[model samples]
Target: MAFFPVFWRILAALITSLLIFHRFSSAQSWDPGYTFMHQATTAPTVAFYDYIIVGGGTAGCPLAATLSQNSSVLLLERGGSPYGNANITDLAAFGAALSDLSPTSPSQRFVSEDGVVSARARVLGGGSCLNAGFYSRAGHDYVRLAGWDARLVNESYQWVEKVVAFQPPLKQWQSAVRDGLVEAGIRPYNGFTYDHLYGTKVGGTIFDRNGHRHTAADLLRYAKPSGLTVLLHAPVHQILFTSRGGTRPKAHGVIFTDANGLSHRAYLKRGSNNEVIVSSGALGSPQLLMMSGIGPIEQLQAHNITVVLDQPMVGLGMSDNPMNAVFVPSPQPVEVSLIQVVGITHNGTYIEAASGENFAGGARTQDYGMFSPRIGQLSTLPPKQRTQEAIDKAVEDMKALPQSAFVGGFILEKIMGPVSTGHLELTSRNPNDNPSVTFNYFKDPRDLQRCVDGIKIIENVIESKAFSSFRFDSLSIVTLLNMTASSPINLLPKHANASRSLEQFCKDTVMTIWHFHGGCQIARVVDRDYKVIGIDSLRVIDGSTFRNSPGTNPQATVMMLGRYMGVKLMRERHATNGPK
Candidate 1:
């Protein structure tokens, strides 16, 4: 065999072996480190805890850990542990986890009325366990706007970072994407920092170098085992409350069902400070609250459910941060990624990318082709001329190329701050039913304009002279969206600037980052301190309480808020207790 052929085979075998190693290695469970993870089947029907926390999810996990340091905390999760679920703990299992529709799989799948497909975690660690594992500290504006103490927020980040976040390694495609981002006018690159800055920068991730995922549940390692008891697969049916002489209703306890469908009652330890906190997500949190009679009184009565608090905003103002993406195919396999490279723009948009993600279908590296040809020099003429040349080249290349090997890369854009908001309300009083969520996206004409701007940005990034050098203009998102056109890449010049066509495309194809928030907002549903406004002994600590969608991935922000809430609750508990 020729020397180059030998080298190619060796490289292929090595890559294959490494991929196999990663798959098996990530298939294993992460040690929960705490010995107290229990199932509802074995737990007691009646339990008492100084603090009863509901929903052991992203926020719930850390909150329980922080609170158990000072109080006997009972953490209840409606799903199983992240451990032993390879899909939840493995980076190679990324797409599989999101697409999982198994009854017991951590991901709970759903589709909206708009025909968009998405899923939420039904597992212990919640979204962190199911999401792409991109970790960026919440934008500073979010903390300030939410009235959170910046000092405490920073401190809380450290509390969670020490357990879950990791600095990711930069490789081929991601590095190329970074260069493309810088070329697209995203600005001065900040190298490998987790801070949310406006520029092209490599940030933190939850996947370690070995492709193992360290989720929020891992933070349970910090839990005081004796003080914290986490019951898995234990879904809370409703918040149990009691009234006091014409005053606001107080959350005293909860009635939840176990994995075996057996119901149990868990109560607060009976101090003025003891409380039940709901850390379920936007949908789950609002759904749970409404089920407990804390929603619009009229809506509850219409459903024939008792109204406890009559708070209209309980399931209002839902924002899921609608997004659109541009995918480019590589000529060879690229390392997988979540969101290592981030481009924060001054415009109301955030551009991020993954090295190995493409939702568009086209000629991939792995596809079969018949012939391979060598073409002459291509031009840098004006877009129309250049696009025609590129389209011709793409057609010629596809027609002649032999069996290929390539990966896909994505340039994703999320609307930074959408004014268009939607809502999530219960489909029924049944706790088992998923709520009806409508993310009334692109309703605002301005939002549509911003999305149009976003598409132009992606087109610019793909068409940049810098990108042209690498043939990055070859198979771009524009070409993919131009699936019906005569020529894919050639159609770019026509559709990229056609704001109306692109806006219509966005309206037709827009999907969410699934960063659902509100439906239980801070000002309208919960107080500044995260306490339910008219209800005592309860708090909403998850994404449900966010005032508005943060610019970036809200996971880090959500976890930070969880820690901050724990610190606040602890201080209040101490104050309620007076002197030591």
Candidate 2:
């Protein structure tokens, strides 16, 4: 692959083996003191900890590790570990993890009530194990809006950066995307930086120079391992609470199930400060809250779950950043890459790209899985599962693609700070099943307009001189109803039937970048300290707390929040002890 920058012949050969096999031996180096990590089946029927955190994902992993520094903590994850999973640890197989729809896969697929497809991380490292490794800090304005201690936020971000973030070496395809963004007037090329600035810039990635991913799970290395217990395949069923003489229900423990369907009860150590933290993603966190009887009275009543707290806002105000993209099938082979270069516009849009991924329908030559396509509409949907009807419809629409559409690159645009929002509701009481979530993409007129603007910019980026070499203007994918068109390398369709107004295009093709946030938001579900309102000894420290998506990607900030809040909780604990 001449597309990649020059490297040693031996190293190149090793990388090829790693990518092909989807495994890396080097990932086991951190397991020296990881004796505390185990499968949920191995856990005792009853246990006690100073803190019990649900969902050992992007935030939960780091939060548990940090809290364990001074407190005995238990981190529960519904999915298995990410270690040795080539689809997760290898950079070349970027989308393979999400594409995997197996019962044991780290990524769990879900379709919203709006018919949009997305995934949630069920693995120990969370989305960081499944996402395209792009790492950029939350913007300064976002920190100010969240009312975080700026200095501490910076410190937390740096701590995470040191463990997982890395400067990526831009390959041929990524370099072109960067040039095209500037050519299209996205302004000052900020070289390389982690700050979420407006303009084209090279941000950090979690994939290190060795082409190996280091997830938030690695943050456990900094933890006092003896004090922290991590159990995998432990899906928390419900949070247990106790009420004292008319006061709010105080969360004291939780009931979770192991892989064998056996129940286990874990309680907080006997202390008023001991707490239960929910760091599940936007979908899981709120779903868990509602299952625990802390949502709207009507919802709880309908589900037959006894209401512990009639908090109407628990599952309200959900927002997903709607994305639209054009696929460009290069006549010549392009270098394989994930998101490394980004174009951040002041007009609430983010432009990004990934190249050389093989979509099952597009490139019949290979089967990386049905979800390998970088095209948002197809890749994010549940494959032959709960939304089989929707997937069948989506695949039927994909039949319009020319063979050229399958083997190329994708240029995607995402709307930031989307004012449009929706809500999540439970379909079943089963904690393992995905809840009914409706992102209501582009519900706000302004959000739809931003999508239009973003599409126009993407069209410009494709037409720019920097991107001309990869453009195949004649190729196009026929329209899918309310679905983003798949291919138009030059952003122009030679077939008249494939053409539509930009606004209509935006409406029809809207998809998700999986940047959904805002179910359990501040001032609604949780307080400034992320403590759940109307409840005691419970907190939510995940993406669900945000009013908006923090930056180009929320993973970086999400991980930072885990560390930041963990430190804050520790400080508060120390203050209460007063120089023990």
Candidate 3:
């Protein structure tokens, strides 16, 4: 009967409820001593810490937790904890989490100078708390190029995985994408593995079976509770320097502000080879560096910041891997899925697929108590108005979902790849404002060409025999530039002007995956050990340290780097009786 499909969906939800109730009953409380908020404004004006790390985000959380094992550590974050936020914890509200423009939302939305829409995570867990939850390791060649010990990186991946990663159950739509990738020439489907391969493979995810998400903040469970002090709503203002006629300006401490407008100074404890580490994501790291007068000489002078160390590449050559998507519509209901399968193109491009919820309780927030009063206060909008607004927004956001209850029963086949680099720079000295980002997407001729090739590869997969059953009368590729779907056949023609049309599409519709990287790097801003070249007792560890985007989802890379830096710093600390 026509109602049978509805009955099955309800049955699934009932089964899922039992699982959720069980999980809630058995869940244990996280370590309490490791966390603090701005309300606990009791921090002394001047406090000493063996390692004072600014930005308790993706890299910061894990790194601070690891480093706190032996030494006293202070971790400061600009955003609140993601632990209790239902919008963040429910995997079903994944899109809503990013679409949320409220300050309280984990993601901070922004537009690049060149008009590319993007966002950054401002929560304690960082990007892992906001991203699409796709997890994959960096390309092996990238690991070797960075001169990182492979064994160590492997161990670091395991450590993060045990806490947050899960094997996604491949359902209908995801399985189709997997076969399409293989049939379209992305051969050798690796069943289930985290190793980066040049074919269709099922990678790990952060969302669990019942759709609960565990963030990098969950890794704090491994922290030395007594040694780690995590202060929320504490944003670092500037890095304090003590020259004392030293050759290199030594970073002695940091000046930051707690939420209640209280100023606090966290200094490296004397007698310990103590230091300050900036793990404040890509944009925040360089901005903080420049604010402390460690960027380009010209920019520093323009901002009236006393030049401590002029590093020209401090905020230059930022690259946000450009992204394009192809939405394939279907009448059949497909189960909701995050990134379960990915196709690694031969030419630095990565293709993945996702399906929207066609099942019951698709409205995650309404069903799961995500209507937070805090979000309305942050957005400065009326409460019900905000709820209604998000619901209206979901109509558009849920298009990639399967067709049963929620609309847009379609399989979203997306492609994101790296090309020429861009830049991220400070617009001003105010840390409260966002930085000036220029993704420079498709600015280079080669980049445009790669995008066209990527489109062609996706088209081939859509037309392949594997996907012949789910025929698409018209394919619409959505970008930041377009409002509605535009057919691929019309966009990519075999006519004389086909090249021109495709080139124009790549230019007009090119958008970013918000996967920005390399505003600061090893040879550019930091040295081999991730220390700023011209500064002493300071280091930068985050996505900014990446020389280039790894051509896959960078969350895994971000967490991996955090884990690597954490383990590496601890080794050096113990070996040298403290940091060098």
Highest-scoring model, TM-score: 2
Q: State the weakest 10-residue window (summed lDDT) of model 3.
A: 14-23
Would you give me the overall lDDT of model 3? Answer: 0.68
lDDT of each: 0.71, 0.78, 0.68
The TM-scores of all predictions, comma-separated, are: 0.84, 0.87, 0.84
**Steric clash pairs (candidate 3):** 318-422, 356-401, 403-409
Candidate 3 per-residue lDDT over residues 455-542, each given as its tens digit:
7777777777776655434433332112212221111122332334666656544555667887778887998899889778999999
Provide C-alpha RMSD values for all models, in order: 9.4, 6.9, 7.0
Task: Identify the candidate with maximal lDDT.
Answer: 2
**lDDT, residue 457, candidate 2:** 78
Comparing candidate 2 with candidate 3, which one achieves the higher TM-score?
2
Q: Which has the higher lDDT value, candidate number 2 or candidate number 3? A: 2
Cα-lDDT of candidate 2: 0.78
